[model samples]
Target: MMPLATVAALSAALLALMAQASVIGDDGRQTADREALPLASIGSLLDLDSGALCTASIVADDLLLTPAHCALRAATDADCAWPRTRSDCREPGALSLRDLRFVPADDHQIAPADKFAHSRRIDRVVAHGAASADYRQQRHNDWALLQLAEPLAVQRHPPLRVAVPDYATIGGTALAMPGYSADRYYRDGNPVADVACTLGFVAAPVSLIEHDCDSTAGASGSPILIRDGDGGWSLIGLHSDGPDPRYARSRNGEHRNYGTPSSAFWPALMQLQRQRSLQPPQATDSRR
Candidate 1:
């Protein structure tokens, strides 16, 4: 679970972001060029059993990063016992180590409509927690590293580099969060991105961040990015939810999006590098 302190700080940031929402409105939202760097590095996850859709990003040639909760697969078999709400079930399982496929899609098409293109099978899902009776309990550990059945070709699918939070420059670089948000997802497959968003101020040991970025169900597990000095983008976190159980509301009774801090997941990603699952991005792919 997310620490209370982190939740409080994010909530505070939410209050500040709301104050600027009027001015930030439609200006912060933009359509991403799908063939570009960051958007090019992202794709969609299809839960075969449930036919659910979620966003995922390539962190390495053979690995994808996303929210673990996105793996929740509800059982409706006769062996299943149901004594609670629709969300709760006995022996609730997950899509981990299952047949979840990652499918790359063109910006103009709905994700499920183009499942055959560049689709890769997921062989494993390494996560801090799994989908269970309660999802909120695993919100802090919402991230998962998915190992693809085969590596993506370097020239065609370069991975996005992870960027950790710099304590010394917390108020620095402008942020952007591009994802396939559910609300406008059907209108056009083009993903909606909240570019040049603000983070206000964050507190240390920050496990989560709150922002005014526009998002919905499909946007979960989308990458929160920071513009680098070289006119490129690096990942700062994975967008999780808006005013979830941890930080339900701000002082002004407003809700903002929450993201799992990338800095907290850096070591785990590096471990994958040590395992040789992560490959170097080509210079041209860097958009330098």
Candidate 2:
């Protein structure tokens, strides 16, 4: 679940729609480019398919970051019940990561059409060591990590850099992302790959950015990107949701998007790294 601020924003949007009777997408509403790279380099957007598909992104070479709720969402399956809604299941291992799998998409039919050209799966997922029982309800700390089975190799795609958890903002900057999603309302259709601009201000400590970036059910874990000083883009946040539900609006209005601020990312990264070392994998793949 999202935090109060996010819920408030969504509620407000819903209210506005009701008053206007002007559906967001149907009436008006709605709304990443990727370099050609090896399947390994197609690093953004990890696919976790339980019943519905969700998206995630790589924050560190070994650490793939995503909303903690996603872990709960995927666990709803009969075979994998992490008990997201219950307080008792909030403990470590409560939301199991052992059964998770990653599958890279080489076509937009798999995810975003124009943003990512290729993708590959991680060997396994490990909970971020610092994850807490309270994370399920806190909203702010909604993040997790996945350790890839192998490092990616690609002709174009490259690893993204993590920003230190500091009070930094890239106001009015150009940002892009690559993700997998299907129109929320149309649940039974193919997922599409897409891209859009991130336009907004930072709400520090909880840096928030507004963008018209289009996303759907499958795009839960896309990376938010801003160009860095060296002309490379550093990951700033993970793709989450907007004001409207999948069916309420079309690609235009409902596509208005928001994400968890990068401020929280640094801590999550450190925690994930430490967890990986303590429970080291037996091997790693470096295939092209």
Candidate 3:
């Protein structure tokens, strides 16, 4: 006995509600699978001596990218402080390579008989000169690159390519953030991920990319990735910090996380690559 027009209106309203719910749900976080490609490229950046953990990504055969603060131990190092300018931030002795270790795709699943083929010791650490040692310009100068003592055996897990696309191009694109979080350590005993994250804002003035991704202490230096049309993912930004209090909270009062875009330090990375090419050949770890 219901009228056709009334039923049609009700149906349309229901559809609208469902669509709105979908959009809101999309902004929420979700964990990625253990076998995800992006997850395979990330590992824990550990302090060899102290066992302090942070996240890092394998961007090249022997190059790993992470936040400078993670390497400098900025939170506790008295010598570490932000510089007034980029030149002042390029001070040496701020980090020691001998104290670092890069464990790629490590989920702590290795058995006693198995060797950690993907783990590499730090040969050298090179942070962005523009990255301030202080919090004044932390957002802009938060990136660093670690040269592994030996190249990762590509057969295990190939390194990801850093993407230096313009901000406008990937402003609103979805991003996947995978890292070794402390919560996971206490709960699942492995690094968890939010594969359905998206770029929240591109604050160019501060040189930081904000994203709606779930991250924590150990998640620093995690890579923010975007999928290419070819079904491959590229490293777009380095997840350097957790949600900023300045930004308005989203669904669960989760403020946006921030990172240094790859474009910001592409030139320095290229220069480092060129410099490495000219260095004399040394013994490589061929375990893998």
* Candidate 2 wrong stretches, greater than 4 Å: 1-32, 36-49, 73-93, 105-125, 128-139, 149-157, 167-170, 183-196, 202-207, 245-256, 271-288
lDDT string for model 2 (174-260, tens) is 666555444331222223333336456435444455555555455666666666787766667666555544323223334445666
lDDT by residue (114-171, candidate 3, tens digit) is: 2124356787776554545454257657788887888876766577778865645455
Best candidate, TM-score: 3
Candidates' lDDT values, in order?
0.63, 0.48, 0.64
Q: List model 1 lDDT by residue over 98-195, tens digit each.
A: 34778664433644344434468887665544443443335555778888889887566678878855632364346788876544444456777777
Candidate 3 runs further than 4 Å off: 1-31, 74-98, 111-119, 131-136, 167-170, 186-188, 244-254, 277-288
Model 2 global lDDT (CA atoms, 0 to 1): 0.48
Poorest lDDT segment (10 consecutive residues) of candidate 3: 15-24
Residue clash pairs of candidate 3: 81-133, 81-134, 82-133, 82-134, 131-141
Residue 44, candidate 2: C-alpha displacement in angstroms:
7.9
Report the number of the highest-lDDT candidate.
Answer: 3
Ranking by TM-score: 3, 1, 2
After TM-score superposition, what is the CA distance of residue 16 in candidate 1 from its true location, in Å? 29
Candidate 1: residue 98 Cα off by (Å): 5.3
Counting clashing residue pairs in each candidate, in order, gives 0, 30, 5
